[model samples]
Target: MKRIFALFILLSAVFLTACGEDEGNAGSSGEKDTINFGATAGPYSDMVTQAIAPLLEEKGYEVTNKEFTDYVQPNKALANGDLDANLFQHKIYLDSFAEENNLELSEVIIVPTAPMGIYSNKYEDIDSVEKGSTMGVPNDPTNLARALIVLEDEGLVKINEDVDPLRASLADIEDNPKSLDFVEVEAGQLPRLVDSEDLAAVPGNYALAAKMDLLDALALEDMPDDYRNRVVVNTEDIDAPYVKDIKEVIESDEFEEIIDEEFQGFGKPKWMEEE
Candidate 1:
């Protein structure tokens, strides 16, 4: 009878240990000592490797970066607790993605982001863009709108004033003063169009991946603050210690100094600029 009682106690202890682990790991990958960070395979990933990870290491945190070639996987990874945090998407995209996926995620902080730009192999400047020239724009709705807004800013096109600029599309163009012909292509494939199209509107990330200089573009989009890429985590882990640590590392002067030195053409987020 004493042996039977002892076995019961041992089983109960093991069950309790398993329950505690489940509760602790409910919202993230079961490790607190190491962070699983995800980003698209480009400048943003470089930001994590070059700037953020060193400071996180100083705090005794190990950062493991996962480079995804496309946009869909990062958030999916975060939602499934395969990643603790990620840094390649803007707040707008994060909100939209979370809503669509029914995932609870939140932005911890925004980071300096590369802006979309108008690149040309033939033209030296916006003024040199010939009328009726072919322009390559992102086929994806979000970035297509961004490209249109940049065109409107450069007086190349006029979008309908009634539409929200964020939702603007080729159909929303009320006027084509330059008679510019827009070719819609995948955003990543845009940099390749630079040599073929008269002008190509390339998102900053893709341009950097293609080794094109941001400053070399004829014009860069003046993006809204929310459009800047942000560090994101599961909303359940929004108040986690590691999230707080990530924010602290980003807000430090060391992060900005690294940005100025390495990420020169990237635009600063409003929070950083306000300081």
Candidate 2:
């Protein structure tokens, strides 16, 4: 009987250990818990909280959004394990940011973004800008190309047609009819300085956040499908089931409602427009 009692205790110990492990992992991969995501502290934050979070919770994820004031911290948090994912940037900004920082970050799904444009507080139109006027463009490669393309389209400048628009830069400008002085500026700073500069190329996100008029743009780009806003996750996590769930949530009808209601000035989805 003593031997039988000892065997019972042994079996009970194994059962208890298994139960402990199951409980410990309950809210992790086995089930969904709080997913800590990051975004810039405006439309991105509002959209995630109002749209993405509710959808995620329906699939069993408790969503928590971390809002940052600038572009740098969201990626940094994602890279450092402080965030599970981020949704503030498009593929172009992500590619440049990831490459320069050596983070193997990649996109999961595309979302609508504010269409990019050149806005001037001083000039009523692009035609009014005098020669030698100094215009501010984003210093980053992707946005700089966008600004250059808009200028090129407006007949103020000529870019080497041989260069892909995605990869074009100041160096690709083959002609400058206005002899406009192109100044490289930080993207976040563009909205505030539009009044001071001859003209400034601004991203839709920042402009919307700053309450600038998207309709008042002197020139706006046709947002290529490649530049659409996307949710980014570390490459290692790209194949994770939770990441797939996040992608599903973003593409759901619930999110579509939020897009229609909240993003009136954000321009149309790039997919809706043809090349």
Write candidate 2's Cα lDDT for 155-240 as tens digits.
Answer: 98998889998889898889998888987889888997688888888988879879887889988877776777788998998988
The alpha-carbon lDDT assigned to residue 1 of candidate 1 equals: 100
Model 2's alpha-carbon lDDT is 0.83
Model 1, 127-221: lDDT tens per residue?
98888899999999999999999999999999999999999999999999889988999998999999999999999988998999999999999
Instruction: Please give the distance, in angstroms, between residue 244's alpha carbon in candidate 1 and its true position after superposition.
Output: 0.9
Estimate the TM-score of every prediction.
0.86, 0.76
Q: After superposition, how far is residue 65 of candidate 2 from its true place, in Å?
A: 0.9
- What are the clashing pairs of model 2? none
